[model samples]
Target: MPYEVQGVVSRAKGEPVSLETVIVPDPGPGEAVVSVKACGVCHTDLHYREGGINDEFPFLLGHEAAGYVEQVGPGVTDLAPGDFVILNWRAVCGTCRACRRGRPWYCFNSHNANQSMTLADGTRLTPALGIGAFLEKTLVHAGQCTKVSPEAEPAVAGLLGCGVMAGLGAALNTGAVGRGDTVAVIGCGGVGDAAIAGSYLAGARTIIAVDTDDRKLEWAKGFGATHTINSRGLGQNDVVQAIRELTDSFGADVVIDAVGRPETWKQAFYARDLAGTLVLVGVPTPDMRLDDMPLIDFFARGGSLKSSWYGDCLPSRDFPMLIDLYLQGRLPLEKFVTERISVDGVERAFERMHKGEVLRSVVEFS
Candidate 1:
């Protein structure tokens, strides 16, 4: 029987999302039906609502989620009912070239459930990031479910499903930040702060956080930032100089541009020490461009300039490890959840997120 549940849906671009009836089908071959326990309200959901992702209308919102496997279809043996799991957008196809090369994290053929959930009227709804989870239940490719320690709180663990994972992977995987490295993260939102936390956990000697908001900077401090720079009214050079000043007249070993704007990217470009890595974890609009920088600058700067995709994470490996760390109190995953809201509160949560008032507003399912 198809399950009838309430899910947050964006019926049109720029319109407020509404709680509506979603009809989820039983798991098909290689699919699973999950009882969603919690889902985080992320900026990406807002982007989808505003049609920033694509013209796909009536999107089933909410992707950063954790849940229990309620049922698994045929051909699925690794997961079973009652398994607590974190949902991930990337479900690697083992036969892909990236996977054959033992780099499944870069899998070119990530997958979602073949079947689509629909509105009561039978209109197909696009699931946000392949996992529409704001409701009480969701359907996903079995591979999208990464079982982790059930001891971790749903609100906290679900965050690893997206933004937080991106930030952590930006430092831990993309930047390869190591002990004694000096790191600077620009943009102190959840993603940026997660980079700071990852840097701190990796034993960075100095962690400097740069942001326009003093409040966000303060949040960065709690995440283990050793220094803070308010770049509110400062020029690019001014921000770079402040970071250099904190690093003994040299720039940081790794500079992460979490703002993703051209200006912030430029700041990160100039704020790293010679041969230092620059990691871009922030998402930029399609209209944004970076053609003005002198071509010679790219040659003169002799280090890797990389963009992190889904934090370049391998869910089956990273998710369980992160959950273990969180359980051990070594990782402050719980700090990322500013508030737990009912499913209907996602619209208002977007306002709070836009105003930078909260790290994450998670929707808890009863």
Candidate 2:
């Protein structure tokens, strides 16, 4: 039977999201119904509200989430009711070409609930990132649910579903920031700050954080940034030179563009040392272009330039281990939850996110 639940929904482009009666269907084959406990308000949710992602209106707008499985459809052998899990978008399809090559993290064909959740009028809803959890109950693919330590707070654990995971993966997996590697992360928002934290955890010697916001830069320091650069009112050369100056005049070994603008990406291109890796984890809009004559620079740079999709992370592996680390007091997962609000507060939370008032505004169901 389909269940009608109150959920945050963006009904049209540039329209405010409202709590609507969302029709969540019973789990079909390979699907599960999650009793969502908590979900984080991420920038992507804002993107959906603003029509920045796509024309997929009436989007069920929350993804970074954690909850417990309430029911599992037939053929779902691994997960059962009462299992605690973090919802992830990248539910790897084992048969994808990338998965066949043994790199499931790069699975081209990801999984979502086969059946559609709908509105009261039966208009199908596009669940954000395929694991919409702003609702009290959400339907998702069984593979999209990664079980983790139930002891972990749902608010903290949920962030691993998206932004935090993306940032951490940018450093640890894509950038490969190893011991003693000098790292510079542009934009000290939640994502960039996570890169800073990841770099610090990976033993980065000189961690430099660049952002226009001093408050965010201060937040970066808490995440173990050894140096902070206020990039506002400064030219690209100035920011690049500043980072170079901080890292023995050569430049950082890894430069991460967490801002995702063309200018920010170009700064990452020039702010790294010879043979240094550059990781672009920020989500750019469709219209943002990288034009100009930089053919010689791409060759002269002599390093890998990578785009980090969902931090190039494998949820099955990362979520559990990260939960353990968080429980062990090794990872500061709690720091990500800047504020906790109820589902009704998500629209205001989006405003807060736009103004950079919080790292993560989580919706707690309780």
Candidate 3:
């Protein structure tokens, strides 16, 4: 039997999302139905609402979520009803070229449930990030479910499903930040702060946080940033010089652009040492493009230039480990949840997020 749930839906571009009757069908083969526990109100949700992601209107908004398995469909063996889980969009197919090469995090072919949820009129709804979670329940591929320790709070744990995971992965996996290295993270939002935490955890000696907002920069310090730069009125060269001067005239060993503008991207490129790495974890609008930077700089940079996909994380591997860290008084995951909100409050949360007033306004299901 199908279930009718109150869900947040974006029916048109540049319009506010609203409560709708979303019909969630029973799990099909290789799929599972999850009773969503908590879903973080992420920016990506707002992006979909604004048609920034694609023309896939009537999007089922929300993704970064933690839930429990309510039902498992045919051919599902790894998960069963009652299991606590965090939903991940990347359900890697082991046969994909990247997976075959043992880099499932870079899986060439990830998957979602074959069945689609719909409106009362039978119009298909595109699930945001293929894991629409801002409702009572959601359906996803079985592989999208990652089991975590029961001790983890749903709101905190669900964050690893997206932004937080992306930030941590940028430092630990992509930038490969290590002991005594200097790391400068541009944009001290949720993702930037996570990168700061990751850098500190990875033993980075000096973590420099740069952002136009003094509030965000102050928050970055709580996440272990050793220094901060408020680039509000500063020019690109001044910001670059300020960052470079912090690291004995070379530059940071790694520079991460949590703000994905062409200027920030270029700033990140120029703000790194000759052999340093730069990680881009920020999402840009479709209209944003970059072609001004000289092509030779890519060759001269001498190290990695990478885009962090969900922090290049393997959910099954990182989820439990991060949960354990959260339990042990390390990896203060709770900090990410700036405020708790009801599902209906998501639209307001998006507005607050846009104003940079919150790190994560999580929708905690009752």
- List per-prediction Cα lDDT, in the order shown: 0.95, 0.94, 0.93
Top-TM-score structure, candidate number: 1
Q: What clash count goes with each model?
A: 0, 0, 1
| After superposition, candidate 2 runs with Cα above 4 Å error | none
TM-score of each: 0.99, 0.98, 0.98
- Give the alpha carbon lDDT tens digit for every residue of 21-64 in model 2: 99999999999999999999999998888888888778999999
Q: Model 1, 1-366: lDDT tens per residue?
A: 999999999999999999999999999999999999999999999999999999899999999999899999999999999999999999999999999999999999998999999999999999999999999999999999999998888999999999999999999999999999999999999999999999999999999999989999999999999999999999989999999999998899999999899999999999999999999999989899987799998899789899999999999999999899889888999999999999989999999999999999999987
Task: For residues 1-366, write the lDDT of model 3, one tens digit per residue.
Answer: 998998999999999899999999999999999999999999888888888889978899999999899999999999989999999988999998899999999987898999999988999999999989989999999999999987788999999999999999999988899999999999999999999999998999999999999999999999999999999999999999999999999999999999999999989999999988889999887789898778888887787788998899999898899899889988988998899999889889989999999999999888
| Candidate with more favorable, higher TM-score: 2 or 3 | 2
Q: After best superposition, candidate 3 residue 159: deviation in angstroms?
A: 0.4
